[model samples]
Target: MTRDNDTERRRPDVRTSLDQWLDSRRGVLRKGIAASTAFTLGASAATGAASAQQDAPFGAVEFQNQTSDGTTVVVDSAILERGGFVTIHDGRLFEGQVTGSVIGVSDYVEPGGADHLTIDLFDVPGAQFDQSQLQNTQPLVAMPH
Candidate 1:
């Protein structure tokens, strides 16, 4: 009982300090996230600067995964570039379903290789976006989006 009371008293202080720290360090955190190239709704790409091909239109790069449940829609990139996002405010526009998105290219392991967008699908079973929702995607050159 005494330990519980003591912990309860300390919890508020811990939370307050944690909140303050997070508020002050939000930009750094966002930058880290952008660098990782895992963009979810409400999170913008502040680091990876993608410059797409001259004629390619700016759109969401999507992927489809065949899960046991059904097909899951995933958004991997902002068209051809890293920071090529049109906007991140409305998750719906990007088909950002309830689960959220963590984006990347499948072939980032190779320094100079074909770029295939890889998106980690979250909760929603139904969502839509660009590029035919390829089951077997073709590799694109590792060019800036």
Candidate 2:
């Protein structure tokens, strides 16, 4: 009768050990799934940002001139720089062709006085823009065109 009771006790112990092992494996699988999901989401976000940057309409510096003559001149930030293409949205400047090089940045201030960023536009001849015209202008958008 003592031997029979001992066998019964050992059987329960073995079953408990097996259950613990299975639970540990399930925990490991859950962790692996979480890690994989995080990696996939991170990669997708990075790719989206890169594609948007490539399609961005604005550059480091954009020029907007509203003339009293009812002509508006929109210049691409890159074209104002040497050997770069500036996209002209309206009437031309400097010639009927309307393209210029960006020479440098100077006296840039944050858009909303938020102390965030300052940007200056310059011509290839080293002439800096006053940037006062942009004060009343609408804030630039971050979305790509």
Candidate 3:
């Protein structure tokens, strides 16, 4: 007979730590966003050159080191560093615009979690990503090359 020991126990299948947090705090996140958006603080002023894309246009992105640091990373807008395109050592080929700015991470669950958060660093003029369904996401400290 097969004995179900601690070493043989199967853990729940959770794709990512970020997903876990989202399932637990769905209401809080939605409400928070609504409340914050409702209270417009400042007027829509003209953004300076600093907010502009400072590097070679990205044709795609491959996330490296995608993990959750017990905090939520909201996909607001890109706060790009005014520089050149970053290349990834072994980054997966992504084809689209990148989202999110918050960078926080704990550790990725190796067995069933992502390895890294890498973004393609190519030059794609008139490229943009659709982020209509973007919500609270797992914190990641990914670096693209």
Candidate 4:
């Protein structure tokens, strides 16, 4: 009977200790969940900010050309001054050219963004302009925009 009374006396202390351990574990778990949630929200905010910046508009270029064969070449801002010339598998290529009465064959100026140049040509003699002729040719400006 004495032994039973002693065990009964210790029951409340054991229960209190177990309860404190569980509460401590729950606090750690809550902190972990909070940290994870904060990290996720921060990453989402950064991605949203980057996407908004990318959505802003940039510079563009336009090209207008007329060939002697009566074929009009109207290249949009994307195709004009694309760093290199357009080439075909058969070895035919056309680079940006500048000449009198070429309509819109002039160096491009981006102003704030990247600088690019667009040279429009009119009345090209042959079926197409020779790509090799533009090789190692430097533009009037250093930036070529």
Task: TM-score each candidate.
Answer: 0.21, 0.17, 0.16, 0.18
Over the stretch 6-109, how does candidate 1's per-residue lDDT look in tens digits? 88876767767777776664543433334234433224334323521222332333322323221232233334333443221123314533223322223222
User: Pairs clashing in candidate 1?
Assistant: 50-82, 51-144, 51-145, 52-145, 80-145, 81-145, 99-123
lDDT per residue as tens, model 2, 37-66 = 333244456668556434333223333333
Candidate 4 lDDT: 0.33
Q: Write the per-residue lDDT of candidate 3 for residues 1-145, one digit (tens) a residue.
A: 3565653556555666656765664543433333222222112223433333332222222343343332222222222222222222111112112222312222222222232333322222343333322234422323321
What value of lDDT does candidate 1 attain over all alpha carbons? 0.34
- What does candidate 4's lDDT look like per residue over 1-145, in tens digits? 5999989876778767767865784543343333323432444566675664344233232323323222223333332122322111111211322121122233333344232333333323343443323233222211111
**C-alpha lDDT of residue 112 in model 1:** 27
Which ranking of candidates, highest lDDT first?
1, 4, 2, 3
Against the true structure, candidate 1 reaches a TM-score of 0.21
Q: lDDT for model 3, on a 0 to 1 scale?
A: 0.29
Q: Clashes per prediction?
A: 7, 4, 18, 4
Root mean square deviation (Cα) for candidate 1: 15.5
Badly placed stretches (over 4 Å) of model 2 are 1-58, 68-82, 90-145
